[model samples]
Target chain A: MESFSRIPSHIGIIPDGNRRWAQEKGYQKKDGYQHGITPGFQLYEILLQYGIKEATFYGFTKDNNKRAKDQREAFTNACVDAVELLSGRDANLLVIGNTNYPAFPEALKQYANHRVHFGRGLININFLVNYDWEWDLKSLMENKCLASHEISRIDLIIRWGGRHRLSGFLPAQSVYADLYIIDDYWPDFKTSHFLDALRWYQDCDVTLGG
Target chain B: MESFSRIPSHIGIIPDGNRRWAQEKGYQKKDGYQHGITPGFQLYEILLQYGIKEATFYGFTKDNNKRAKDQREAFTNACVDAVELLSGRDANLLVIGNTNYPAFPEALKQYANHRVHFGRGLININFLVNYDWEWDLKSLMENKCLASHEISRIDLIIRWGGRHRLSGFLPAQSVYADLYIIDDYWPDFKTSHFLDALRWYQDCDVTLGG
Candidate 1:
């Protein structure tokens, strides 16, 4: 068992490769996403076990909503089921994304809120449905509301299947953050993989002025 | 001439060891920082030569306010002068800290704004002073603001005279950024180091979904 002395206070995950995982398993692409529910839930449990206080999963990007109607519906169903399962556990749920995805299902939104309202422990599950970093920064700068100093602090950043760069998630804000990249595809992501990531976080140093 | 293809979009400097740099030159710490200004400006010119757009200097953390009154005044004077010099150039200046330091002279704030306004170009030069990342993220989340995500965006992140970890600066956001760490102390940082970092950025591949 890895020591939990250095468990990260927060972790962010970019879940990737549901379609590929499904195709590889000889299941429909949607089936691969459906399969992701269990592992994603288990991953949350493992994070909780290691005393991680916060985790953010990129449930769906704005681009995902651009898929065909049938495909979007299937993906939404999978997401709804996944949220339901994870919400049953004792963790906060935060859904972060742009809120403008036309294809975003009401059921998923309702389910996410339901999880927050009923979860055993307060979990921050946010979805960024229609978020854009540049616009936000521009607005902040224009309004003179942008704080000159430190605004947000991040402990751990997890990217499940994306490339190294941020792809412009939160550019101005992430001036300083610890990052963890996982090789497992989002659909294939398992509880053990999350545990492994947490284990790495456990050893990360947060010393000032290093 | 180094290729501008890999120039870093964003650069961060810790501006460490003014006292040490001063001692090395057989001068007072105050003299070291005053002398440091020339090289810092020269480095900025090099960044412009390489087509770099954004740069941040880590000057005067919150702890600076806690230092001896004389020392803090001297540091603030140097900062004001530095700001004046950069503001006269072709750069949009961003002062990265609250103007709440008692030790800081009030005249410096207006000088900073005046210099930035004078530069009047697309160039962005920011100073990260007394900034905290965690609180900023929370405010964004609470206010329902979204961060932008664009294709092939935000090429590189540089940490000068700082460690690899996030250490509470933009914790949630920094996870996805590509980082470059330098061994040179901030006071000793030069144009070559800035160019080297830019070179690395030029060579970085920004393709997504790998």
Candidate 2:
């Protein structure tokens, strides 16, 4: 088993580039969503093997609903499937998003703001669907903290598909996250990509400001 | 004259690596602050040349005050000096931070929350001194948005010293900002560094999730 002196307790995953990966494969944009599902389980197993405490996966964003109806349905269905797949796993699962919004998956709404254990609850898994940074912060208008306050601060964020923008991840929690970008698309995830990010994270100067 | 097809209207600058640069040059860690000042002005002039509308500079965080007395004083002095230096420039200067706190520089108190037009106010310059992400969000308790709400959403954030973390910069404003990291120390700032980041941003898929 691979080991390291330091491991991020909470890792935020932004699985990007599904459309590009689909285009490159001569497939329609909507077809790429299904291909991205297997990698979710693969990463979960890796995190479990590595003993990572908590992980958050970026499902479709609220803005992503702007896409064509077929593409939106494809991604929404993929998110529901991904969450159901994790429902049978050994983790504490919570789906965070605007449930009132029509775009949010109804199947995942039962898990919203409520953590449910599948088996042993060895790790925490947060799935964000129909999420927006502004919507997350809007809760602060009435509450003292973020709507997604249940999720702890993120130690590291791993983004795939070569984009350097946060694209509206958990803003408050990501204040001190060390971002690791993988050029490969989400569907093209390799075990090596995650291991490389872990290895690179070993050298981060994590002085949360001081 | 260097130009680009797409220019970020508002750019966030995190000038890191001062202490490392100081140590490398056989100078005390505190000595690095003064050297980082000139680069700020040089960048301001470049922004003017490029017609960029707004920029925010990370001076020092509240957590930075936890450093040794000498280092704290050094960075505090640097922030004050940098703000004073900009006082003569043609920009609308607003210093965002907890002015009520004793750790904040008294000299910058006049600039807090109030936009002071230096000359013609051609550009907006926001200098963060003794700032905190939580503190910025705390304003949402009473107000509808961030304490730094006057500053619009950031388009690009350029960080020096090679760190990939936001380190508690304006969280809400940085939600979708593209991050660009420069490996060189802040004191070793080069005009080419800024230009290179702009060149790289030209091809970014500016699709805000669409």
Query: TM-score of each candidate?
Result: 0.65, 0.99
Which stretches of model 1 miss by more than 4 angstroms? A16-39, A63-78, A87-101, A112-154, A162-177, A182-210, B4-39, B61-78, B84-97, B100-104, B114-124, B128-155, B162-178, B183-196, B203-210
Error of 2 at B173 (Å): 0.7
Q: Write the per-residue lDDT of candidate 2 for residues A1-210, one digit (tens) a residue.
A: 778889999999999999899999999999999999999999999999999999999998888988999999999999999888888889999888988889988888889877889888989999888988888898988777688999999999999999998888999899999999999999999999999999999999779978
lDDT of 1 by residue, A1-210 (tens): 567666656566666667777778787766666766677776766766666666656555444555566666676777667766665666555444434455555656553222354456744544433344444354454553432122234566676654445554554434445556775677667667766666776665554432
Per-residue lDDT of B107-195 in model 1, one digit per residue for the tens? 55653322254445766776654544433443455554322111112345555544444343433334345656665656777667766
iRMS of every model, one decimal? Answer: 7.0, 1.1
Which portions of model 2 miss their true places by more than 4 Å? none
Decoy 1 TM-score against native: 0.65
lDDT of 1: 0.57
